[model samples]
Target: MALRISKKYIHPPVSFLNNHFQFLEISEKITRSKIQSLLDEAYESRINNLSRSIGLAEEALSLSKESADKSFIGKSLSHLSLFHMIIGDFDLSINMANEAIENFEDLDDAKGIADAKYTIAGALYKTNDFSKGLTHLIDCLATYKKLEDYHNLARVQKSIGTIYEFFGDIKSATQSYEEAIDSGKKAGDLNLQSNAFNPLSGLYLNQNKIPKALAIIEESIVIKEKTEDIRGLAFALYGRGKVYTQTKQFEQAEQDFLQSIKIHEEMGEKLGWAMSHHKLGALYIKMNRLEEAREILVRALEYSNKNKIILIKFKANLLLHEIAKKEKNYELALKYLTQYVEEKESVINDRTAKVIEGYDVISKMQALELEANAQREKADIIEKKKIELDSFFYRISHDLKGPITSLMSLNYVAKLEVKDEAALKFLSEYDAQANRLNNILDGLLRLTKMSFNEDSKQEIDFEKIIYDCIASYKFLANYELVEFKINIDSKIVYEAEWALVNTIIQNLIENGIKYARIEDGNKPYISISINQEGDVIKITATDNGIGMDEKTIDNIFVMFFRANRKIEGTGLGLHILKRAIERLNGEISAKSKLGEGTTFTVVLPK
Candidate 1:
């Protein structure tokens, strides 16, 4: 007989605030301090005394509004939203979050807006609004990445992974979890790490990677224990119980589930406590302990019904139905089966309604598109304005370059003529400033040219272009200390605009070398790999260098974004690379860990 492993596990929404007590500076210090203290109390007692926590958050909100401090008001609303979600008041949570977002936006607070969105996303998840939840999560991910907030980034990534897993996109889910793990490690937050680990283990288990699943879940359990995260430990133990049940270690599975239940009951986590009881009952049924299974299943059913946990309620009824049949109680089996079917249909209907709601949104969007089609004249006018803007940039870039070049030439002559150390120093500074301006103008010119020019397609010589890129960077400091490893398939030749391809490859290599760590005993190396799979060309550039934090990686492709201040750069290399790839309808992504290294991957069509 095939092993039947239960896949129903509770993944609670992350309820912790990103910046709970870190309030912005306001004129009213006394009010601000009072609000902060109230929020601190709310967060501390959130689990143990939920009603008190809610009261404290409400008090903070009232105090914040009285102070007329928008930042404090937003923070208070965000905390209240989180507290609401913890108690399963999802609609209230979402309403509070939306209000918080409005307040944050009025102040142009990106972090505040993101924090509120994160809370909204969690609430949306509980409400089964996965589409909206995923959208909010993606937005939160971008803000967290740009802020280089690793702790929140990890949390967002894990949430994204869960959504992807729900959609049955295992590959994307796995990638998201892996990214979460990376960010969690970078943040040095063991609790965050365990959050990712638990879900990741479940994914592995789904794939029948039993040993791998067991190992990761155990690792999470250890971290949760060490961190004294009683809530997290309960979840971890519940997950481990599932793993043990799958492995046919029934006694170990029972023990883990019982411990999880004890913890959940102590913490007053009704949903988790009930879920653990249901799972333990299921295990008993598997072991043919019919009487034990029947007892626990009935208890689980009552708790689930009281909590309105529809999923668990239906599942427990089904288990009871099976136990009744085993005892040859036909009438009782029929009754339980009827309840199971009715409850299960209710769940299906709810999910169906949600799907229909999504379709309704799409239908509205299509109607909007049709309305937009009637405004072609306005679109044409906007296009013309865009063209004019491009022309202005192109002209200005050229216009500025001449003066910049002249300034540089004059500075060079002044350096040659000036004999005094002070005068030479002044000339050197002038020269550097001139060069920086020149580089900026050059970047502007390239950007404008990309906007106007047509693609000049040619067979890309990956090897020669890579070699040229490295040689051009030879003048950079510590260039001699870097090792370049290039690997390209001899049979692969991608047909694309040479300049675009070169731009992508060169910037990646330059970024690696420029940021290469020069500390004693550190051997910096750049590895470039290129290959073609079917119609897509894949290029990866990796470097063991002074890697970036999450924020830098997110903004790396933005115009004039500089990650390293010490390195002499135009801050336009990666931006140009991104633009060039976009021009070719290609995609680019980066992953990095501070003090470890970075890897850039580009996927382009042939």
Candidate 2:
């Protein structure tokens, strides 16, 4: 049995983990006092080497039992439960967790009991024993709340919310999410806050609250990026992608799904990967990219089936059925449809969302109406708060940019005037800091401006725009050494919001030049291509620079995100580009591997 503990939800960073051989070397000299410590260390190995971790855990358990060390025995059982959960062994994990809970209960250890319950609930949730899982989770929540362990409380609330969402109880789910956000804020846990934000954003999206959903998801993405929570970020990005899909923003939807899938694959999170693939396939199908859709749907189906992820499998099969039907493959279509129907029915029956038809509901109409109004009022407050923050950013950015620019100019002049080497150096350093600050402010202005602009489509010279974008980047370092390849169809005439298009092209071109792995033996070059495809203009920017890993690529467009810490960047370039693309009703997607390089494709309405 694969005991899979989802890094998407339950991630306790193993700060104490090191090479397994180091622990093995130390264990040879271990005393009875070191037995429990060794067992604890064994659990940490699950992140690096699960099989060895499990073996060490089993050895420790046996040693503890032989030594008659009840404490070590209990801890080893608890540790084993978590390891099992991580490897997708739900039954064994649940059994071990329960046993650990009993032992902790006997010893009157509240924290230990809570930890065991948390693991048990997680395993039970994965096993589809929702009612029982909820019971354990509620108990865990109560214990955490009583202990004022806000982080764990937030985690439990998020888990509970997920269950309620699964059960189709939106009201309960919303309440749980709200509680989770509150608790996470109190705990200062960005991971919990971001995790809670994902489901909550989905709930809002389901209700057709697009702005609210985007706001919530954007906030979640920011927090996830800050915490470097790749799984959490992927989940949040998927939620945003869903919102984009709902609004018929296919381009943005495709980009989000692709980035999310890349991150999920890199993290080895099967569920996220399957779901993202499923979504991307659906998007491709909607876009009439039948072959691509079919290919992705197959991957989604295979992974979901192997992992026993029912919902993702059901969705993938449904899309596959559609693709087969579209291709006029009746037999294949029928087969896919049948499988989809079976999975759907199985899921529906298993979930069996509880619904009540009661006459008393009519009598409570007046109170229900009041509650609705109150909820709307609360929503309005949230909207207003977001607006205020946006306004603050816009105003502060505008106000600061002027003074900063002036200061930079003054510093530059001071450097020129200063004769002493020390004074000149100090001025240059001050000037550099000022320039950095000015760049940040400029990025903020660009971000805030994104919301202010409306679609102002005009005749766009496709070739000229690309040329201008590239020209602006020529002043940057290595511009002369780096080769520029332009492949624009000279006859192509596109119409778009010129400012937004310009921003998008400029940032992308600049980033390709800025982050290119220049030191590497590979010749640094940027490939720019633009062509008209019916009513759309396809533009691609390919770079032979230092490429990004999936994790870094997922966050490359996030505000203040920088993939390579060794490189200097405002992190605002890609973010501003995304905002610009969104404003222009265009889509931007990227593909990259660690060393190969990056390719960004932009599709805009013509």
Candidate 3:
């Protein structure tokens, strides 16, 4: 005889339910509630959550094997991967994802395979192999597209956009995000679509395209509210707040950031709450509210550390450094600033560097092609000019040399003929002026040569460049008190144009020394530091000097950029440096505070 069900439709007693239920039906499928319960317990960590998750998964694996239900087996495999990810065993997660993928593939289950690939991509993303992660995600996206899995495709695109954003490629990032939004709308996935728009807006904000960013984010916020995805709404609002901060709309930024923090707390998204706090701190600092900034930033730093979000932690520290400086707290400022020094070092081996390297190679090929094109065009336009051009250069070289040599030779002759000290001084001045003119011509010649070089780039020692610049200029002694720091990762090396690298560093370092504040007329100072992350080296030259305003900054690297003609300059140091660095496909930027200091960073491909 079977046991009859005696309990009312309340929560059934465990023993009765277990005994009276048809075990086959109940165990064959899990309800949404049951899955959520397991996931929550697993996420919360039941001291032995790994063991519990594994146990349940293994039990389900056995059951599915007995039932010969491949679908259930695929679910069990996914569960194992989730547990692996939860335990921070990413290698195991990768293996489990692969296994799950194989199982799902065998079942010809596109949906199951999509999920598995996403898990694989997530693991890859965590390990900092963002490119590989992005590849797997794109594969997942293609599968979703075939299965009409618009929702999941949107999710994948959002993440891919994030990787692009991280590398500072706003164009690619925005394109990915817009595709996500379109896909999400088609699938009625407002939450995911809103999520995509929010981050995309932040990217536009960084580019100073305020109107575009604001409009998109506002629409996203509206969608989030309509969908009632409270956490999604919070992040969207928070992202908008970040945009406002960038635009210096401080009041709105603070309110939005605080509102986001409140919502994040209510939703139990602690990491999001942490990021909001840090962003709020940045706003406070901008408003000259240092105390609030410091407190909030500290709270953020603690939370970010626990979550393993180093990017937020580093940025928070950078802001805190600024706040401390405002309070005349140099020690704390220095400490906080040092935290980012390591992370800035980690910018090596990223996708951006790889892309830049690839771009360099492609550009070389393109340049060759362009040269051919230009030659063909020139031949067509000026068939008779080659003889004339050659004759002109020959005449000019010979023509210019006569006067230059005569002037220099007369200066030397005068020195030998002069008997009085006054005549000797006059000859010395003439020689100096003539030599300066020759140096200018030499520089122009080198510049012209750089425009058409076909030589293969080779590795050069950065350490040697630093030392030679110092010894050749005797800049250290010229400065009364200088702070010089060189932090090079000994193994950091690059395949680049050697002569150009030397010239760039020489010009940049010379500028740093010249512009830096000296204790007295006899004092000059400069500091240099180098650090490595994966394959790139970051070189920084910092100094206590009078820094330029935004107007001057806007044109610092433009051709013939002169901030003050009263100050002796060719208006070409940074301009020439930019051209040389660009030839190597390198990036250089300056960060400065008026009457505070300046630091220039150069990122070269390795």
Candidate 4:
């Protein structure tokens, strides 16, 4: 996110994710502790790993939000928030969601806000705050509806339906899921339909409608395959295996369960793998294959305990205890059951802790955003004040230029009309003084224009412009008969503000003329050159001049800082030149020897 955490970053599309499920795959390969940690990341949604494909996503999101990365912030922040949701940290999820919610206004990024809303609603649903969550969820639905984002809308509806199913609101749940399935069909999004089909199939299975449940789940597997939804396919396979187990179709049930396990192993979905093992254990028990059942159940218990997944632990505990009870190891059975309850309670306590943490995070982020917005407002006020002050100064100086120049020029013309020799000398001195006033006014006007000019940009030939400026000034420049040279290969072009460049060049030349040496025996010279190196273009104006001390050179760029007030007139040229060069994304620096020469070089991007 930007400072407000409400700016945008570009995000990877869901289509990018549609290709595979890395979370499940990582689960299969790593050690139990590592796999558990990865799940914690996925659940906490904070784990960043490359081998863990989901971490690839977090890395991308993080890159977008760092510093003022406006380009990708919108995408990353909300993605991280969704990560929080997937892991069940509802408060953190909500905090991220709310931060993302205002991104649409930062830019006209409706899709960004929509994604944030979706994440927010999901968090709310996860934490059992269904009412307010539904509002955001519904708002997201409406946004997606307008966008015609059928693929995403279907997912949201399906999630809502799943929650309803969890709450035992069968009718509403079925309708909502059905709507999602229908929407998915229209959108050609088989993933959403496959997701919706789970609850539908699960509902039927629980009611003992074996054939209907089997048919729906089989269809879900087909859709999951079509969509390349490996995770959904694995779950669907599990569902089908359960149906087979219940129907006493032992051979088909074994085939389905084993197939599910193979896929889970490949995908590294620990939860899926654990479920597969638990089911295998149950099926073995049914067959009175006690030894095989015990082996698989024990492994399942190990994974469940490591992951701190209470539900899995509970199921594994019941199976292990029953196995013990059947063996007449009553004490062992009781002990396993006791451990199961304890593990289950621990998982619940952890979830409760996360909920509290999430709330605090949300509150803190909201406060930070509010403060940042206040600072932004203050910054805007300061900028406005600066603009107004500059505008007033520019307007007054601009209005004075024409009259001042006219008056000075008239005095120059009157000097030429003087006839008497002594009077002519006096008039000529007056002319020089008037010309000084004219130079001052001209410099002032250029400074004012450079400060206030607001015009469109164009690609400029920097080399040509500098050469032409030198040519225009060559004759009028009243320096001693200095050896003036132009040493420039002028093919470089750059994006620039034209008037600004002209003013900059004009000022650099004027400064060169004003400072050039004037002595009977001294070599007085000024040279102009331009060069390009990669993306940068450089211009150098060199002069064998009566140069300033290092201290004066340092102060020269400051507005109205003159090395010699006796030289007369305004000292704003270098300041104006600096501003002009900066505006065109160029830089200027001076290298000089006081009794030898000065080289003023300007560098700009091409």
Could you say which candidate leads in TM-score? 1
**What TM-score would candidate 2 get against the native?**
0.49
TM-score against truth, every candidate = 0.53, 0.49, 0.47, 0.47
Error of 3 at 319 (Å): 1.3
Query: On a 0 to 100 scale, what is the lDDT of residue 383 in model 2?
Result: 76
lDDT of each: 0.85, 0.80, 0.73, 0.72
Report residue 341 deviation for candidate 3 (angstroms): 1.3
Which ranges in model 3 have alpha carbons more than 4 Å from their true place? 1-70, 76-99, 105-108, 247-249, 266-271, 348-606
lDDT of candidate 4 over 36-67, digit per residue (tens):
34334543322222134456345655544443
Model 2: CA > 4 A from native: 1-69, 76-80, 83-87, 249-251, 353-606
Q: Which tens-of-lDDT digit does each residue in 455-532 have in candidate 1?
A: 878888889999998999888787899998999999997788887787888788878988998786899999999999
Worst 10 residues of 4 by lDDT: 42-51
Q: Estimate, for each residue in 1-606, the C-alpha lDDT of model 2 and write its tens digit.
A: 999888855744464345565685576447465676677667555434556677888888888887666666778898888777755667788899888877787889887888888888777766566766776776787678679999889978888888778777799899999999999999987777888889899999889888999999999989878776666788889999998998899999999999998876665556668778988898898899999999999987887777767778888888999999999999999999999899888877775631121112322534665897899999999978856876898999999988998898888788778899988888878887888888889888878877765767798876677787777777788787788898988788777777887888788788888877767467898998888899888889998888888888888888888887776778888888887887667898999987888999998875
Residue-wise C-alpha lDDT for candidate 3, range 155-220, written one tens digit per residue: 888887877776667787889899998889999867777889888888878888899999989998
Ranking by lDDT: 1, 2, 3, 4
Q: Which wins on lDDT, candidate 2 or candidate 3?
A: 2
Instruction: Give lDDT for model 1.
Output: 0.85
Candidate 2 lDDT: 0.80
